[model samples]
Target: MAKPLNLLELIPKRIAKWEEVEGLVVILKPKFSHPWMREHLLPRLKKPYYRVKLDETGSSVWRLCDGQRTVEEIGKILSQNFGEKIEPLYERLSYFFQMLERNRFLNLTQKDQSSGQ
Candidate 1:
């Protein structure tokens, strides 16, 4: 049986490529699921992909999830950058990550609980 995942040890990685638009993170979600459709039909539309604009904190989290940093490390960085404004940090981070995962925006890997990142 598999062990339960530790929130701190989970590493988040972005699945979709993103860009900075006016200092905010804008994720591009492909409109078509199949490659053939994307190639043959996507170009016909004015907008190729869905542009998901993230808020300041979400943008910061999105930028940090480069497949390297663990959730704990991200929380530490956010705490340092946002201070009290990000009170109740871990809970919010967990929710944010869950939502991202549910929406297929990012993927999470469970780091060994005994290992140090």
Candidate 2:
């Protein structure tokens, strides 16, 4: 029988890809709200379409999430690349993944993720 997957193993891929603009990698922020708000409040707010901009580290991680590497593998790469700069690696990485998942940014491969909040 196969062993059940852990949290890290469950998050084995990212399907939300980013586009490169000049030297920066960016994802377009989708506007979601009532049509009235979109036609009214959004224009007045003047929010940029590409709201979430990844920094150097985030961009690196985003690139590494190519649907084959597990979260642990990504963590190892981060450790090697960043060295001692990012302490408590798993916590930070997990939180980052969770944030991405929460914001509907990451497309994880977990079976139940579709119904997740």
Candidate 3:
């Protein structure tokens, strides 16, 4: 039997590369799901990719998810920057990560047990 994952120990890695515009994070996702549609229809649209814009706090969180930091570490960073604004941080952070993962925005992987850090 496999053990359940510890939320704080999981590392969230961004699946799609994003860009920052006016201090906001913009996730550029391909509009078409099929390769044929993308090749044919994507060029016809005004924009090839769908831009998912994120708010200031969200942008900060998104930037911090670089595959290296665990959820706990991200929470600490958020606490330092947002302080009281991010009160009840862990619950909200967990929800945000869950939502992102469900939407295929990120991949949460288990931290390596062998690497002593």
Instruction: Give the whole-model CA lDDT for all candidates, comma-separated.
Output: 0.92, 0.71, 0.91
Worst 10 residues of 1 by lDDT: 108-117
Model 2 TM-score, 2 decimals = 0.67
> lDDT winner among the candidates?
1
Candidate number with the higher lDDT (1 or 3): 1
lDDT tens string, model 2, 1-117? 986756576454554546776666686664645677667766776552545777877777788877767788888999999988877888888888888877777766644556651
Per-residue alpha-carbon lDDT of candidate 1 for residues 20-78, written as tens digits (9 for 90 to 100) = 99899998988997999999999999988899999999999999999999999999999
lDDT of the structure predicted as candidate 1: 0.92
Q: TM-score of the candidate numbered 3?
A: 0.90
Per-residue CA lDDT of model 3 for 6-96, tens digit only, reads 9999999999858999999998888887999988999999988889999998999999999999999999999999999988999988999
- Error at 29, model 1, angstroms: 0.9
lDDT: worst 10-residue window of model 2? 9-18
* lDDT score at residue 61, model 2, on the 0-100 scale: 79
| Local error of candidate 1 at residue 85 (angstroms) | 0.7
* 1 versus 2: better TM-score goes to: 1
Local distance difference test, candidate 3: 0.91
Q: Give candidate 3 misplaced runs (Cα > 4 Å).
A: none
